[model samples]
Target: MIRTATPADVPAVHALIRELAAYEKAPQEARATEEQLREALFGERPAVFAHVAVDDVSGETVGFALWFLNFSTWRGVHGIYLEDLYVSPGARGGGHGRALLTGLAWICVERGYERLEWSVLDWNEPAIGFYEALGARPQDGWTGYRLTDGALAALGGSGH
Candidate 1:
């Protein structure tokens, strides 16, 4: 069954994040700490949300999906932007991934959001195909960019 993640699920979610990073070929890049996750999920002003898939019989966490609300300037509505989605390697092929996405889609429809979206690495053909099969079209000709940590600090200090 799928359910909203509470603060206590931070450890499991963090481990899933690491697994996702490893699947993306960058295990060392997962820098999220359990404390950080707790703060993010249970802070005075929470910045993100998560859902988990649990086994009915074993009561084991089988998957997790982390996302946040993003504003769409064109649509003028708040939409869910999925950041990380991972299903335990042994728990895959059991509809967990699609079930997680369906849950998020239900949230969007219930809230009148215009879209539900996420990014997949260019090399992950399997994932790209999976999303396509779900009727999600890729937005081509769009380039992604990021400025983090030191670069972000430097730019902020530049006082534009």
Candidate 2:
């Protein structure tokens, strides 16, 4: 069963994040703390949301989808930008990933949003196949870029 995550789920979600980072071969990059996640997901004016997939028999959280809203200037609607989607290795192939995505898609359709989007690593063939099987097409012409660490600070602190 998939349900909205609560404050109590922060630890599980944080662990899942580290697990995902390891799967992505960059455990060191999953630097977020539970406190940060708690604030982001349960703060007074929260900007992010999370949903978890629970095991029916064990009542354990097996997967999670963390997302946030993004405004599309062209579409003029707010769409969901999924930040992370992960299912525990032991719990995969049990439909948890699909359920999590379906839940997010339901939200978009219910709210009249034009898109539900997320990025997957180019080399993750398994994930790529899964997404393709779900009718998700890659935005081929676009290359995603990030400005972070020293560069982000330098630009942000610049007066220009």
Candidate 3:
């Protein structure tokens, strides 16, 4: 079952994130601490939200989905931007991943959101197939961009 992650689940969620990082071939990039996750999801004015899938019999956490709301000025509505979704290696080929996604889609429908979207690495053919099977289409002709850490600070300083 998929449910909203509470503060008690921070450690498990962080572990899932690290697992995902390793699967993506960037084990060193998984730097988020459990405290950081707690603050982000449970702090005053939360910046992001997360959901996790639990084993029915074992009650063990098997997957997680982290996301934030995004607004599309052109659509004049808010949508969900999925930051990450990870299913444990041992839990692959099960319905946990789809269940998590279906839960998010339900949230969007309940909230009147225009879309639920995310990006996948071009080399991740399995993931691409999974999403496509769910009837999700890629936004072609668009290139993704990022500005983080030092680059983000440098850009803001230049604006000064």
Candidate 4:
């Protein structure tokens, strides 16, 4: 079953995040704290939204997907930007990942969004194939970039 996540789901969500980080070989970079997650996901003003997939009989969380809205200048519509999608190793091959993606796609269509986008590491061939099988194509011409911490500070100071 897939449903919107609540504050009560934070612990399980964090556990899955850690599992995903470890699988991606960067466990140490999963620095999110309970307080931060709570504030961002359940506080008065939400920064993002999440959906959890639960086992029907066991009632255990098997996977989750977190996302936020983004505007596409070219399409002139707001679409979902998937931040993370993690499924426990034990739950692999169970269709949970496809279920999560389907749910998100339904949300996009229901809301009239023009697109949904996410990035997969180049080395994660399994994930790349899974996404391709779902009819998603890689944005061949675009490269993602980010500025963090000191870079952000410098940019802020530069006022440009």
| Cα-based TM-score, every candidate | 0.95, 0.98, 0.96, 0.95
Report the C-alpha lDDT of model 1 over 1-160, residue by residue, as the tens digit.
8999998788888888888888999988888899999999889999899999987788888899899999999989999999988888888888888999999999999999988989999998978887899999998899889999999999999997
What are the per-residue Cα lDDT tens digits for candidate 3 across 1-160?
8899999999999988888998999999888899988999999999899999999889999999999999999999999999999899788788999999999999999999989999999999999999999999999999999998999999999976
Q: Candidate 2 — number of clashing residue pairs?
A: 0
Q: Would you list the clashing residue pairs of candidate 2? A: none
- Which candidate has the top score in lDDT? 2
Judging by lDDT, tell me the better candidate of 3 and 4. Answer: 3
For model 4 the local lDDT of residue 108 reads 94
TM-score computed on alpha carbons, candidate 4: 0.95
lDDT of 4: 0.92
Q: Order the candidate numbers by lDDT, best to worst.
A: 2, 3, 4, 1
Query: What lDDT, from 0 to 1, does candidate 3 have?
Result: 0.94
The most accurate candidate by TM-score is 2
Scored by Cα lDDT, where does model 2 land? 0.97
Which is superior by TM-score, 2 or 4?
2
